[model samples]
Target: MSNTPQKPVIGISCGDLNGIGLELIIKTFSDSRLLELCTPVIFASNKVVNFYRKSITEINFNYQSTKEYNRLNNKQVNVFNCWEEEVAVNPGQLEDAAGKYAVLSLQTAVAALKQQQIDGLVTAPIHKKNIQSPDFNFPGHTPYLKSFFEAKDVVMMMCAGSFRVALVTEHVPVKDIAKYITKENIVSKLHIVHKSLQRDFGIDKPRIAVLGLNPHAGDEGLIGNEEETIIKPAIKEAKNSNMLVVGPFSADAFFARKHYDKFDAVLAMYHDQGLIPFKALASGDGVNYTAGLPVVRTSPDHGVAFDIAGKDKADASSFLTAIYECIDIIQQRADYDLNRSNPLKKINPEVFARMEDEDIRE
Candidate 1:
């Protein structure tokens, strides 16, 4: 095996075929600059690609089909052709077929990811409701990936430039959100966010700010006691564990004055609390990254737009940003591993031991 480190091989899945999944992928790969960053591989079949190409007016990109990673064309995009069945393509429609094929593509790409065939995965938007099946019963990609990697906890972190926000409770109904905001859950998510910054984003010591669930941060137990009873204690515990975490800050003021810029990442109490501000700050151009996964997985911040699926009005900017974010994360993780393996390789063990003994004797 050649020991040379080349461009990363990025695996992509066609999410909710009836949505704008394929359109975003096609538009992202059309830019030759992305190809220079990483080798692109779409797990969908030729039929799927052709359908989208025909539906859309103008897009230019060629692909070479391959079942294995070694045969991937570095210059051209590669299509793995996970499914060869003849299925009707209906853009802007939510049907069972779309969900089935979406799950198939995701399963195929995840297998490749586990085998180390691809460096990372950038999933297009999948309709949460239609994509539910026996094989995929999770709420969203974050939870499914958490189960696949067997990670204890994973945070759905949205990123744009230096501003990042992670969710404490994702994909849960508003009524049930309060029940999940226990101290244990908050502490676990904070640790994940802290470690992810140090490992994935190359922050040596990450300082994280956490958001409160209630307005005005529960007004110091007057409005709601979750912040004082749950969130504050969780932050204290995380700090005791040597993590640089702070806040039970009111969600309103935190984002209002651009306070998120001061920290490495923010931990929001729920989905809308984190995502609403993130989307506003990013101007609908951000990437959703699954933090604490053994393998890298990111997606566009937006969802599958069935309304504008076939109208060619889908924006590919977020998808392109996701591709770049995956590439950067893969490289950062490798570097983190390299540095973590040994910090004193240049120092002799015998000499260090002798010095310790001398110090003890003195």
Candidate 2:
């Protein structure tokens, strides 16, 4: 039997069809080299894909349309049709129909993920406002996924190379942000980040830095007491559990001084506190990864660019990076699980003692 590993089947969710989702997908997978890395299954109809393919005349995107995973073509891009009805494609326009289809694509892809039909998922950008409905009403993908998988909590982590920033609270209003910044919440995120670093990113010991909610970390309780009361207690609790966690660092000085380079990841208090600096430092190639989920999921950091939808002005760097990160995480998780499974057999103390005795005799 061949020992070579089979390519992972990566599920792709078509986000906001009228937006730049299809354009980015077509451009990124148009390169045949990416096919060698993993098999891609796009969750959308063939008609929708052809609609966007006509707009971008520069590259040819050939794909196989199928409804069955058992009959998937591993060497070619597979378009798993979520809906067959002919939908109108308006490139820069926002319509309720587009949102409906986006939800369809997401639901289908997530179903496949739950069934283990796909190894990992790479979602394209979705307009948060348009994609909201009775069935799918969440701020973004992070919360929706957390609800779907029944995870107690999930961290919204932004990644660019080794520079990572996870949000303690995401998609909450500024006024409500302080109420959610409890010591228990911070400690939960720390535990999630710590496990994700080890299992997903292949880090043995990850150093995490936590940013404060208030200005100058509450100026040591003069400005606000979140750092001294909530954040400090949380850090202490995480440290007690043997996690390499530190800080209540002032957000402004941390990024300004490039102090992020010293840690494996940073935990920000809210959405903007972490994302603003992450987007700036990531330089258009950042990926949003939902950490602490049973299944691995990643997406392009940017949103649905309605301004550049049909003009072919969309950059595929971040989307491509998301796909690569998804594949890498799947592999890392497999390696981590294999190493930890049956640990007693992996390290035999008797053999180690015999080897040490032989070396001592010599």
lDDT per residue as tens, model 2, 113-179 = 9998998999987888888888888888888899999999899999999999999999898989999
CA lDDT, candidate 1, residue 297: 92
Pairing residues by index, what is the TM-score of model 2?
A: 0.94
Candidate 1 lDDT, 4-87, residue by residue in tens:
235888999999999999999988887777788889999899998988877767777677888878899988889999888898
Instruction: Pull out the clashing pairs in model 2.
Output: none
Error of 2 at 78 (Å): 0.4
Question: Which candidate wins on lDDT?
Answer: 2
Instruction: Name the 10 consecutive residues with the lowest summed lDDT in model 1.
Output: 338-347
- lDDT (0-100) at residue 210 of candidate 2? 98
- TM-score on alpha carbons, each prediction: 0.93, 0.94
> Over the full model, what C-alpha lDDT does candidate 1 score relative to the true structure?
0.88
For model 1, the superposed segments whose C-alpha errors exceed 4 Å read 1-5, 344-362
